[model samples]
Target chain A: MEFIQQVINGLAQGGIYSLIAIGWTTVYGVVGVMNWTHGEVYMLGAFCGFFLFTRLHLPFLAGLLISMVAGSLIAMAIDQFGYKPLRKIGMPRMAGFITALGLSTLLRYSSTALFTPDPQAYPANLLSYKLLTLFHINGKAITVSSLHLMIFLGTLVIMAALELFIRKTLTGKAMLAASQDMSTLELMGANPEKLIKITFAISGALGAAAGVFVGTIYAINTMMGSLAGLKGWSVAILGGVGNMTGSMLGGLLLGIAESLTAGFVSTGYKDAIGFIIMILVLLVKPTGLKGYSAEEKV
Target chain B: MLEVNDLHVYYGNIHALKGLSLHVAEGEIVSLIGANGAGKTTLLTAIMNQVPRAQGSVSFLGRPTAGMTTPMIVRSGMTMVPEGRRIFPRCSVLDNLLLGAYARKDKKSVRRDLEDIFTSYPRLAERRRQIAGTLSGGEQQMLSISRALMSRPRLMLLDEPSMGLSPIIVEQVFATIKTINEGGTTVLLVEQNANQALRVSHRGYVMETGEVVLEDSSANLMQNAQVKEAYLGS
Candidate 1:
């Protein structure tokens, strides 16, 4: 029963990490930019959700939608007005990296300055306290919280939708084309710049949703994004950078490992679990679990 | 129809193309055969608007195309299958073909074109769901050609289609190019494989150091002494 409960908790937590991992991988895949500000985007998403809920007096679902859209727009603006011009100049790749790091710092400090440092909590009693028992044995029962259930189902739906979007849609095909070869993508009559803007938008939206979920589970804090962002990067590397499905699997696996480690092992080592998993994956398979070997362009 | 006049292109301090000019009439298979470093690829890139040109006038379908975006150039009924097999490797063969119609908005026409491309390249139909990157070199080249055909272009620019493919594949690829041209799509081909290119082309130009050194029918260039020695290895 305790094991079942732990598994449920792990699944819920994995849902949040998977969203962030998706955000990281999407931008990396399309733009070839390691957007460090992605974490700040997630943090800002939670802030957006909080602001809407308290200031606008909107419902939780409405707040979530607003956060997703707003976060996506903000990230697109950054990519277009901020990063695209730099790219036009044929700027060095290192410059883009530095620019991303700078943008991350700028977003973090700006968000902190705008929002209060004190933690903000979502309204209480809005989410139900109902629990459903999945199995019972030896007079002990295994139960799942409605919140956890929502998290699990919502993550699966979103992930499935994203997979379908990338695989089936015209715009998604363009994105995949751009990711593989931007120059060739242009040859196919696609505007690679537009694809990149869309990538950032999608990545930001996913991060924002993760932020909202975190705020719902825990509380919104200004600094929560940095730590979460680092964990998300770890998840990306673990699953293989630029591989979408790999990131999701990596995030879930990391989540379960962390939860189980904290539960049965040492709670103090929970923070170190992500990096440890990354190192292990790197040592075993450098291309990640599903990453293909990069071929040289002729 | 495509007309390039006095085109000048530069990469930083290096002058890649210097006062190059050529013309390809409707339904004509024109070949630009040149030695390495002769700016063949640059000419194609400049015409496709992929590379920035310092000074040039490209008239496509009898209209000036200066300062146009790549997609805009493509939308004007011209598309390029870039140098090397630059197929989107991670995507499936079907996705690659579908993306070639990226600029087209007519869904019914797009579907028809897709069906036509699959018919032309039946191997693609068999492996439509397979990732392009996993495909063999010959198959990737075929995908590249099939993908370009999906765009439904009036003019197709093929840059070195025979590059890096087996001799057997090259023969098949040239045969396919002939078939594509026979099907009414004008082709402007650039290649270092001068023999194969000239054999398939109607008219040919010999480019050297970004300048057109000679222009004639494919047979005349094949018999030209300089071309025979420098490019055809005869």
Candidate 2:
């Protein structure tokens, strides 16, 4: 019963991680740049939702919608101002890495300045938590909350839609190809710049959605972005740097592992367990489970 | 028509293309033949704007191609089948073909071109659903050419289409290039296979260490003593 209970507890957290992980993976896959500010995007999004819902008295869905749009625009603006000029001059790749770190620092500290260093909670009555009993094992009932179900379902639907888009749509297919070989994609007449911007937009939107989840289930604080962003990048690496499906699964795996560690062992070991498992996975399968095989391209 | 005047390309300080000049008139099959590392691939890449030009001008159809992006170059009806048949390995054959038309806005004509390509290369039609990486070398080359054709290009740049293929496959590839040229698309081919290239092309330019050393009609170049001794293995 404890095991089943831990699994239920892990799913929503896993859902949020996967949303954040998608942001990291998609940007890395397309631009080959580590978006250190990714978690900040999520943090900003959560704050956006928090403000919209709390101050403006908007509906929950409306708040989410605003976050998605605002997050996407913010990400695109970063690309435009920060990376586009560098790309124009054929910037060395290390410069991009530094740019990401610099951007992350700037966003985090500025956000702290804007929102203050205190944690902000969602409205207590924002979401009604209806409990549902799954089944009784050994006279212990396994229960799930409405909020948890919403996160899980939302993650499932979003991931499914993303997968379909990549496989079926022309622009999505082009981005997948661009991820493989941007130069060849250029010869095929797809603009790498446009595709990358689109990638950032999608990634920021996912991060924003994850931000809303974290803000709702836990609490929003200025300090949340840096550590959460680091974890998101780790999840991306643990899955496979460029594989979207692997990141989703990796997120779930990390979530369950952390929950189990916190439940069965000590809360102190929870974060440590995720890194240990990721290192073990890397040791065994460096490419991650569903990673692209480095087969001959020609 | 394409004209590249006094082109210079540099790989760091290596200076891969040194004052190279070449041209391809409309409806002509032109081949650039050279030894390995003789700047043949670099020239094609420069024309497509893949590499920064140190000094040069590439004019296609009377317009300067200097500032155009590769996709913009393709949209203007000039496309290249890059060396080693750089097909999108994970994409389906159909998807590869669709992407070839990425710059063009004519959806109806693009679909019509797809059918024409399928009818022309039945092998490609059979494997249209298969991942491009799984195709055999010859089939992959064919798919590459077909994909370039889907752009409805007035001129196609083919780089080493015969690389790693058996002689039989090479013959078929050259035959297809010839046929495509006959069907009215101008061809600018780069090849190390001097014999086949000179035989198929209407004209040929011989390059040695980043410079075009010889240029003439293919028939005359085929019989030239220097060409026969150095390239044709007389």
Top DockQ prediction, candidate number: 1
Model 1: residues >4 Å from true position, as ranges? A1-4, A137-139, A295-298
For every candidate, the chain B TM-score is 0.98, 0.98
Write down the lDDT of every candidate, Cα atoms only. 0.87, 0.90
Worst 10 residues of 1 chain A by lDDT: A289-298
- Off-target runs (Cα >4 Å) in candidate 2 are A294-298
Candidate 2: true interface contacts recovered: 0.75
For model 2, what is the C-alpha lDDT against the true structure?
A: 0.90
**Docking level for model 1:** high
Cα lDDT tens digits, model 2, A1-298, are 8998998889888888888998899888888788888989989999998898889988777888789889999899889988888888775688987998899889989999999999998887777788989889999999999888887888888788888999888898888888778898898788899999999999988989889878778889987988789888888888888889889998998888888889999999987887888788889887776677643222
Q: Cα deviation in Å at residue A130, candidate 1?
A: 2.9
Candidate 1: the clashing residue pairs are none
Identify the leading candidate in terms of lDDT.
Answer: 2
Query: What DockQ do the predictions score, one after another?
Result: 0.86, 0.79
* CAPRI-style docking class of model 2 based on DockQ: medium
